[model samples]
Target: MRSLADLNKQGVVSFGEVIVDYISNNKDNTSFKQFIGGATVNVAVRLARKGISSTYLTKLGDDEDGVFVKEELVNEAVNMNECSMTTTKKVCKVYVHQNENGDRIFHSYQNPTPNEWLLDSEINSHIFIDTKVTYFGSGTLFHEKSRRTTETILELAENFHQIIAFDTNIRLKRWESAELCKKTIAAFISRAHIVKMAEDELLFLTNTNSVKEGLAVAVKWAIPYLFVTRGKEGAIALHNQQYISTEGLNVTVVDSTGAGDAFMAAVIETFHDKGLPQSKTDLEELLTYANGVGAKAVTKMGAL
Candidate 1:
């Protein structure tokens, strides 16, 4: 069997929701700042920017917001032929509220929204089959319809023998209960070959405070590699019974909004374009590239 590095070097196919972020920096702001965002969509765009051929699969509405998001992806040269449109709801919007500590509190509106209620017919099986890597985040698994759609995509990806990469992008407020979020995310975790999780996510998914104990639980699912992200402390990967650590690039903190997404994008692009994960040298090189990308993302306000 070919390794994940070989598969990623071939290219990638990503599936998830693409949302228009309606953000505000002022308390009584007359209008909000809009940015094209969504975890998988950002990954696809960044991959394209890095000269990787990327296919983005998802549903968007025919509304103005949706048009803007699609146009942004098109402008970035992402392959969006697998994307669909529904005229029912406007695009998904995320309203951001900041606390005194500068931590963002998101108020999202999504319930049977056009994108969330995607039909399986909207996606093309051939696209999934042709891609070397199929990536997605757990955010889209909250709703029943979209959850089912995500599951179907995973099944098709397995059939196509694609390398399945999952990001444990747990959003507590999106689900009805923390228990439910853990359960659903575990289902996807069991299916992924490569998993990217944060330090806090280790505690949430495993109910443990230690990364080692958390990794023990994650390894039980037979995931080949696990990357644990430690903000500013850098990232560590547990693979082949060795710990590969990389230090973060020192940079001014403007907004930490899309740093992780940027890092994920860099890793995926490196794997797809350069057949990485072959050696520790390759891992270190990619980590260095990702650190640069992540640091660059914070200089901007939102995901592009």
Candidate 2:
């Protein structure tokens, strides 16, 4: 018989933004439903929910929302040893719009706060010495200090032979321009061992209108594996030279708040459950599980 204790898994570390997401029901109403968000944060919390320990690295503000975010992390059992709080804070808002069929679209976003101080703290590779994987979001590049911090982590990962994952969570509203975003995203993808992004991010990175053209661009990157989320169309995985796409699940989306994050967390959990796929069939099966995880995530109100 399989012991239940055998199900417990090793923890992972996530580095990047930690934002308070204010999700509105409609474009007209900007008030309702608040949650602790940010792509990597979502991944960490979900992994924790799956019985995995997670060390979160980022800076929070010494404010109400920051306290709320801290409490949420505590409730989820995410390690906050690397997390710090400063004197100031900012909240990011997501105005959501849903199609009649329950597809969520983030119509607008505003992020007036930034965390440059978090990067000032020297990088400590020792803290991640035993972590299962080190995951981060590309949005961290928007700031000079945070960008250096990200690059440093990648460097340490390379030196230590640690697994590194990157999520290209492109929020157009926060970028100065799409071209700059693409340049930075492309650079990060080239260095990551595992990369994940939504279908739209592929389009932006490739500057194309069609998925096929976008894939042509996606495949050129140096990443060992790539995960692309396509909402109702499910997700596709590119490993080695093969591409495997799984059918999307039908779910009534309350909000698309953390669908991609959930998908990435599932991918990590799958890798933890079964070592990173070594064959084409294994990759396909892994992506199918990821799509299912993403679908289930949308049935809720926020990332968690």
Candidate 3:
């Protein structure tokens, strides 16, 4: 296992599904445009764009959609050496519907090979040998195979003493029940050093009515860093018993598909560059920068 000093010199490993996003090009949901997307994929690409070395880890099919996703990641300079390729795993597809305000609504998902995932047996300490941070989302937690894989990776991350960053990018439709989703996410949260979630996600998980109540409930998890993002309104963060807020940047809305992912990337990049902020002032500045990155993401058509 690498020490903290050695890990600081390494890059981030983003693990999750890489899906094809079919975005509705019109308010009537007629025309559509396909983009390489997924929460972790977006974070990996954005980190690469910011000159942060990023390695994407996921199992991809040998099909055309998988090839397209791989090509796009390569184009953005994200490393794929740690990724897996197989013939049995088909790429996941999701339909994104956008309102006039440019906010995205996940309409539906088409997954032909939901059972296929990077097996726990395929994972080893070598994957985290040069990884300073390991980032993931809850999308894979609903599946038994992927869930076990996630657990294996989390164990390796802990053993390596790498920063564990988690995003509760919850999709209710993916889980069998709301209770199961909450239970699974809570288990992961307990293992994470840093956690990012939308304001609504926070509320849902805590079963609270407001952000304050949600934060109050979540602080008990003892996570080192917690961020709650509010679209357009900006974000709030809690660290070391201090709460700090930052206002969102004013940007024209084009598509809100990957805004949260961009925000997560920016925050991770900041942590990569300068270890976790030690003061409330520093944490506020970090959140402010992350807010800007998220705002910029919404000004583009695709998540990248």
**Best by TM-score, which number?**
3
Ranking by TM-score: 3, 2, 1
In model 1, what lDDT does residue 176 have?
A: 82
TM-score of 3: 0.95
**Model 1 misplacement above 4 A:** 1-9, 26-31, 105-116
Quality of model 1 by C-alpha lDDT: 0.76
Q: Tell me the tens digit of each residue's lDDT in model 1 across 1-304.
A: 2233335336688888877676667545345787778778888888888777888887777888777778889889898777887787566667766656665556565545543556676767878656778899987788887888888888888877778888887778788899999999988887877788888898789888887787777666666667777778788777766677788778776667667888888777766666538888877787777777877887767866
Instruction: Please give the RMSD of candidate 2 to the true structure.
Output: 5.0
Q: What is the lDDT of residue 279 in candidate 3?
A: 79
Q: Top lDDT: which candidate number?
A: 3
Candidate 2: clashing residue pairs, number: 0
lDDT of 2 by residue, 1-304 (tens): 1011222335687888777666766655545677777888899998898888788888777778777878879888998877877777565556566555555666676666754446745566787555557788976887777888888877665655556788999877777787888888887877777889888888888889988888887777756889989999999898776788988888887777798999999998887667678888889888988899999988978877
Clashing pairs counted in every model: 2, 0, 0
* lDDT of model 2 at position 87: 73
Question: Deviation in angstroms for 145 in model 3?
Answer: 0.6
Positional deviation of 54 in candidate 3, in angstroms? 1.1
